[model samples]
Target chain A: METNTKILACEYQYLESSELGQVLTWLEEYGEKAAVLAGGTDLLVKMKMGNLQPDCVIYIKKIAELDYIKDDADALRIGATTSLATIERNEVVKTYYSALYEAVRSMAAVSIRNMGTIGGNLGNASPAADTAPPLLVYDATLKLVSQQGERLVPLNEFFVGPSQSVLKPNEIIAEIIIPKLGPDSGSSFLKLGRVSADIAKINVAVYMLRSGSKCESCRIAFGSVAPTPIRVPQAEAMLNGKEINEELLGAAAQAGAAEIKPITDNRSTKAYRQKVSKVILQEALQAAWQRAGGAL
Target chain B: MERKWVKIKVNGKERQLYLKPNDLLLNVLRDELGLMGAKYGCGIGECGACTVLVNGRPMLSCLILAVTMDGQEITTVEGLGDYDQLHPLQQSFLDHGAIQCGFCTPGMLVTAKGLLDENPNPSEEEIRDYLRGNLCRCTGYTAIVKAVKEASKAV
Candidate 1:
C-alpha cells in the first residue's frame, strides 16, 4: 500500500531504490499513473505552480548507476543523473565538444548547474533548453530504459511537442550518446538571454568542418525560435564548400532566420528573437569555423 | 515510506537525524538542525542563496533531499572558519566590500569557496562563470569577482 503526503506546496512520494524493481512493476501495474523524479528542478516548480500533481513520484536519485560520465570508443556516454557542473568540468567534453562545454558553462548559475542534470533538461523538452541545439548539431542520441527493456532514439526525434517527450511512464532517460567528430571539425554554442544567468531568448550552435578556406560540411541549429530545436538545412547547404565571406554569411543568416518560427514570451519579443538569432548564428558559425583550423 | 537514520558531518559537528518523507535538505538544515547559514531564498532552485558544499562541491540545498545525503559531508557558511578565525575568502569578501544586504553573502561565499577549492587559479572569466548562479542586487558582481581572485591569491 502506497501512502500519499504533501509538503511545502508540492505533492511528494518517497521510495527506496531496492523497491524500484517493485515500483517499476507498480508503474506497469498502474501505467501512466505515476511520475519518476530525477533532479526535481522542473517538476517541483510545476508542482509549486499547481500544474503537476503526480500521484506518485518514484525518486531515482538513490539508483547509484544513474550518475556517471563514461567515455567509450568513438562516443561519450553521460548518465542521465550527471549534473551540468560535472559536464562543464569533464576534460573529455571540453576537448572534444567545446560547444557543449560552453553551453553548460553559460547555463543557469553554479548552484543550479550543480543540481540540474542534462537528462532532466532534455526530458523537460523546453524549446529553450541550452544544450539541445548544441546536441542536435552533434547528432546526439538518447538511451531510454524501462523495466521491459531499453530503446535508443535520435535527439531530434525525442521531442514531439513542447514539454512533451516520447519517454513512457516507466521508461527513464538513461544516457546521452555523443558521436565522435572527424578531422577539421569544430563546434560552438552561443545564446542571447536577458542576462548571463537567464534562459536563452535565442540560442545557436554551429558544427563545421573546414577544408582550406572553405567549409567542407556544416550544421547549424537554433532553439527558442521554433516549435523545437531545429536544424537549418538550407543554411547548412548554403555554406558547403563556400569560402567564409560576408556575402555567404549574410545569405546563410537570412536563410537561418527564415527557417525559425518564434513566439512572444515573457523573456523576449518574437521579432527581437528572430533578429538576434541570425546575428548569433553567424557569429557562432564564424567562431566554430575558426576553431576548425580556418584562419579568421 | 521507509525512514532511515542519516548521518552527516555538518559544520564542525556530526548530526544524526530521522528525516521525514518529504523533508528537503534545506529544511533539515534550517528547520530541524537550526543551521540558518544556508538560507531558503527560492524553494525551486533558481536563487543561489541556499548553496552549500556537499562533499566539497557547491550544491543547492533546496534541491537536495536530506535522506539522500546519508554519509555525505556538508559545509555551510558557518562551517568555513569561525568568528575567531576567518577563511581567506571570507576575509577577502569583507575587505573588497562584497557584502551588500548580507542576504546573498553566505551563499556567495560558499559558492566561491567551492570554486577556489577546485581551481585555486581561475581567470577573471572563469570566476565569472563559476559564480553565475549567485545573484547579488547591490554590487553588480565587479567586487565579487575581485574578492574571489584575491582570496585565491591569499590562499
Candidate 2:
C-alpha cells in the first residue's frame, strides 16, 4: 500500500470503566492482558503499527478521580488524565512552574494537546517525552494505583529505560505531586525539535533557587540524551552555592556535555548532540538564571 | 468482537448505531455516517487530516475509538456549513485560493474555526501555531494562513 490506510486492526475488545474502583477491579482482573487507554494518542498509534495488541483496552480518561489539577496541602497535585492543554493554560502552572508550562506548550499541536493527557505522556515512557525533563527538575512524584494499594514513586526513579517504567501491569499512575519551590526560585525549558511542533531532538530544563547573587540550589535535566530522561547532577553541583555568572555557566555546560550519554538516532547523532550539548546547556542555564532574578 | 450501541451527537443531530469496539471515530464518521469531509490522510495522530472537534476542542479522530465517544458531541466539517451557505472560513479559504488538492481543506477549515471560536482574533503567528498539525503539501500553507486570517475578520 502506498499509505497505511488501515487505521486500527480492530482486534482487541474495548473495556470502558471510568470509575476508579471499577478500573482498579478491571486492572486486577485483566492484569497484563489489559492496556489502559487515557488519551489514546500513543496507544492507538502503537496498535495501528502492530507494536501492541492487548486483549482488553481499559478506558481511564473518564475516571472521576484522575482529571484535575489543584493545590494539595504542600504540593501541587495533578491528575494523570488531565489534558496537556489544560495544564498549558493553567495560570498557577505558568506562574510557578514555567518549565513544565513551556514543556507542555511545546509538546505537540493544539489538537494533540487537547487530546493527550499528562498521564499518557508519562506512561508512554518515551525518552523524548517533553514533560519528563521539566517534571524531573521539579522533583515531581507519581502516585501509582492498583487493586492492592497506592504507592508514591519519585519521578526520578520512575523510568528504567526507553519505553519502560517501574509500573506493573495492574498499576496505573493516578496523580503527580510537585512540591512547591521557594519564592526566589525560577526554572526554564529549551527544546530543539526538527519543526516547531515535532518530537525534540534535544531538550533541556534548569531549575534554581536564587539567594541574592549566589545560586543556593539547582536541578538540571535533559531529554533525548540517554536511555531515559535524566538529571545531570555533576553539572548541577557546579552551580550549587556558587555565584551566578557567565563563566560558571560555561564551565557547567562543558561538564554537562561530557556527562550526558547521547546516541546516534534517527532524530540526531551522538556527535552532533555532543557538539551542541554545551551550547544548549549554556543557553538554558542562562535563561534559568535570568528567571531566578539573577542580573548576570 | 464486542458490539455496543454508541450514541453521539454529530452536526446537531443524535446518532445511535451498533459498532465494533475498535472502530475508529474517523472510520465511523466516514464509513458508517457517510461524512466524507474528515479525510484519512494519516492513521497516526501526527497528521491532523482526521481532525474533528469533540466537545468543542480539536482532536484527531483516527486516534480515538468510536465507542469512547459515546454521549459526546462531534462536529465534523459537514457540521460547519452546507453547499447552500458555506461557512465563513470555507468561503475565505476559497477566496484566498487555499484549496489546492483539497485533501487538507476540510481539516484546515474546522481547525481554523476552532481557533477563531477560542481567540476571536488571532495573529498570524497564533493562527499558524494552532494549525500546526494540519498539513498542506499543495499550497505551502501561505494561502491557507491568509485564508484563516481573512476569515478571522469576517467572522
Candidate 3:
C-alpha cells in the first residue's frame, strides 16, 4: 500500500516561548522570518504545501498567558491561542454568543477543532473563515502586541484581503474582546458547505435587537461572498427601526444579496452564491428574531 | 535545524527519541516507534487518517510537531486492541462488517474510542457527527455507524 506522507522540506529553528517578552524579542529579531505557531493546523499545512518557508517557527502554545477565556465586566476576553473546542464548550459563549458558538462548532470536525486556535483562524485571514462573520456581527475587537506596545483592531477592519490582514510583522494577535449583547438581542449563523465538515461555500451571520415590535438594531455579515468578510450596512439600515416581518426580512435579504460582490469559484457559482446569500440571510434573520422573543 | 531529545508517553509507555524540529508525530509513531497502524491518508489535516489521541483529545498526528508534544500522553490505534484481544469497538467493527480495504480503520477506531470514552452511550446522530472527520471510501458508513452503536451498547 502506498501512503501519502508529507516530509516538510525546509529546515527552520524551532523556538518554544513561554513568556510574552521572549516572543516579542524573537519577533523583533527575526521579523518576517519568524512564523508563529499557535495550533499548527494552518502553519503546518502551509509549510507542507511549500507556500510558507520561514527561517524560524516560533511555537507559542507554551505561553500560558495566551490560553484563556475570561468573562470581564461587560465583555468576554478570549486569549488568541484558545482552542476552538474551548470556545465551543464555554457556557457563557454558548448562551450569549450563539453565533460564535455555532460558527466554532461548524468548523471542520472534532479533531481539527481540538488542534485549531482562534488566533490562528484570525491570523490566517481567509475570507471564508468560519469565525470571521460571527465576530463581525458581535463587534469583536482583536488585541495585537509587539515589543512597542499593544493595540486593538476592530474585527470588521482587520481583514484586508484573502489570507491577508493588517497585522504587522512585529505584531501578534494576543486577545479577542467581544462585547456583551444588549437585552432582547439574539444572533444566528448559517453556512452552506459541500459536506457538513467541508469549508463553507457561503456563510451568513445576523444579530438583531428588538424594541417592542420594531427592530432596534440589526447587523448582517457575509463570508466567502467577497474579498473579505463584510457587513451589509445597507441591509441593516433597511431593517433597523422597521417592524421585522417576513416582508421586511425578504426585502432586507434582497438588499443584502445586491450589496455583496461574489465571484465564481470551484465550490460555487456567482449566481448560486447570490441566490443562496439571500436565502441564508433570511433564515438567519428569522432565527435571530425568534430567539429575541419575537413571534416569527 | 537542531535535533532535540524529547520524552513522550506512547500507548502508556514512555519513549525518548532524538528528533528533528520538523519531525511530525505521525512520522515518529510510524518510522521510529514502528507503530504503523495510523495510516497517512492525507498529509494535511483535511483527512482524519492520521487521527490520534493526545491527552484523551483526538488530534491529527500529521499536524503536531513531535518536539512540542514532549511529556504528553499519546494513544494510537495499536493501543486499542489486537486481533487476539479485540476491544469492544474493534469487535463491533468486525461483527458489523465495518472494515473495507481497512485503510481508514485505525483512525476510525481511535476516533471512536475517543468519542465513546467521552460519551459511553452516544446517539446515532452523535456518533455520525463525531466520526464525520474519519473518511472511509468503502462500507458506505451504514455498517460503520452500526458498529459504533453496537459498541456503545457494550461500553
Candidate 3, residues B1-155: lDDT per residue as tens digits?
89998999999999999999999999999999999988888888877989999999999999989999988999999998877998999999999999989999999999999999989999999999999999997745999999999999997
True contacts kept of each: 0.55, 0.85, 0.73
* DockQ, candidate 2, vs. native dimer: 0.79
Worst 10 residues of 3 chain A by lDDT: A1-10
Best lDDT among the predictions, by candidate number: 3
Error of 2 at B44 (Å): 0.9
Report the Cα lDDT for residue A271, model 3: 95
**Cα RMSD for predicted model 2:** 1.3
Q: Per-residue lDDT tens digits of candidate 3, residues A134-239?
A: 9999999999999999999999989999989999999999999999898899999999999999888999999999998888999999999999999999999998
Each model's total of backbone clashes: 3, 0, 0
List iRMS (one decimal) for every candidate. Answer: 3.6, 1.3, 1.0
Judge candidate 3 against the unseen true structure and give its global Cα lDDT, from 0 to 1.
0.92
- Residue pairs with colliding backbones in model 1 are A109-B132, A109-B133, A110-B133
Would you give me the overall lDDT of model 1?
0.83
A1-296 per-residue lDDT for model 2 (tens digits): 23353567747878886679898898899998899998988888888877888999999887877999997669999999999999998889999899999999898899999999999999989999999999999999999999899999999999999999999998999999999988888999989988888998999999999999999999999999999999999999999999988999999999998889999999889999998889988998998888989978
Clashing pairs in 3: none
Candidate 1 Cα errors over 4 Å, as ranges: A1-7, A18-27, A241-244, B1-4, B140-143
Measured by TM-score, how close is model 1 to the native structure? 0.92
Docking class of 3: medium
Q: Which residue pairs overlap in candidate 2's backbone? A: none
Runs in model 2 with CA error above 4 Å? Answer: A1-5
